[model samples]
Target: MLGDIWNATLKGMNDLAGSVGEGAREKSLALIEDWLEIFPQLAEYGLEITSFSMGLAISPSLNVELLGKHEDWSDEAIAKRLADHKGEHSITTVLSTIRTAYRLQKKTQAPLRDPLILKIVVRISPEVRVVLGQPILDD
Candidate 1:
């Protein structure tokens, strides 16, 4: 599963280079590589790191975006979407990149003031949420 994520993410990063400048492209790739290095810890929390990859171009650091897809906003939505959906436009590359922009805010740590990056706790699967001790609620 993680391998798929890594491959997909790597391809996504490579493809991203064409849409951005040379320096911005390299920064984006480095940031994704950094995130992938810590993927186990991030994955343990049950939230698939999402949209903030491009934010890395502007600032080499970022919290992931849980609202990478509108329906991915909550675990319930994630579960439902997983169970019944197929071929979502945003889900095409394991996540969406359109939501990312150079102007997006950034900080030293996660759970930023940005609404898109919020909801990660609830966005996680129920079991992982329990382990993480985050009381599940509507996202």
Candidate 2:
């Protein structure tokens, strides 16, 4: 089940890269690689990326939603711990790299562009279940 989910996620990411255009495909793939590298670190904090969306407009941006589960901890506590740990780990650096890659892509792409934005939203949940055959949860 886990392997299937992983494979689907990779396919989705590859589709996103292809949709972004040839010029930016390499950068998009790199960003995906960077994200994969940080997954284990995030798991240590009981956090997992639930979903992500990318938009191109005046500002090319990627929005990532993370769901965290810490049964004994309050949402605020989880958020605080993740924030502190993020600074101590490669999260901040990787985010910066992603933003830089988007910015570079923006400069080379056609049409007008603004600064790239990487928005991350973290939410605390008591439990997270990966429903079989579902790529993403509705709730």
Candidate 3:
């Protein structure tokens, strides 16, 4: 069940990218790669990115879903862990990195703009049976 949901979500993201022009698609894929570069840091907080999607519109945004390494870890636990290390939650850390990257990209003649919306979801377990009507991380 979980796999189906994830697969569908990924497919939707792919479709969105395909619908956009080639330039936007390449930029979005590149942004995803840049975001992946932070895997090590995320691992430190017992978090691993499960899936992600980038949306380019009036305001560019990146939506990320993360799963905890341990089944017992809750969203608060992850947030606390990150706060202890970086004085902020996981979302803040990720957003800061993303915004910085966007700024650098813009400086290099990229079409990305500032104030990018970043949405992060931290799931305690991968055994979720439903994608809807369930409590999300940080809820």
Candidate 4:
């Protein structure tokens, strides 16, 4: 899934990079290098994001009525989870943040359409954090 997006992002970057200056090309290559370095770190949290998205889809306050339509509830695990009754609370909590003030606005759209790679840990989970933006901005 991420490999597809990574390839597409790189293709777009390379295709659009042709008319740019030497400095710009060098910067883009560096950014891509950084992205290549960081993308592998997100593999550990695979199902969490999907579960999070599913929670968003079922949220009544979020106005997403196409819940079952979006996710195939026919799966044994999903069916069992829904049957359990207690699973909904946990799923919702995992995806939501409570604001202290009366500022909770209606969420008309889903939080993530495509996964954005913002940061990744290099070589180890609790090790160095790197950003894709770092390379482009580096002098």
Task: Give the best candidate by lDDT.
Answer: 3
Would you list the rank order by TM-score, best first?
3, 2, 4, 1
- lDDT by residue (3-120, candidate 3, tens digit) is 9999999999998876665655556555555555556766665555566765665234466765542332344554555465574344356534443544455477844322222335
Give the true-structure RMSD of model 3. 18.5
Structure candidate 2, residue pairs in collision: none
lDDT, model 4, position 82: 40
Per-residue lDDT for 1-139 in model 4, tens only?
9999999999989866654545454554443344343223223223221221111111111101111121222235343444553444323221221111012221433232222212221121112221211133532
1-139: candidate 2 lDDT, tens digit per residue: 9999999999999987767665464454444444556667655655566677665532234456555432423445445655665754346553344434435545777443332222352221111222212234355
Local distance difference test, per candidate? 0.37, 0.47, 0.49, 0.29
The C-alpha TM-scores of every prediction are 0.23, 0.31, 0.32, 0.24
Residue range with the least summed lDDT across 10 consecutive positions in model 2: 123-132
Flag regions of model 4 displaced more than 4 Å: 1-20, 47-106, 109-139
Q: Against the true structure, what is every candidate's RMSD? A: 18.4, 18.9, 18.5, 20.4
For candidate 4, report its TM-score: 0.24
Off by over 4 Å in 1: 1-20, 46-139
How does model 1 fare in lDDT? 0.37
Q: Output the lDDT of residue 79, model 2.
A: 51
Clashes of 1: 0
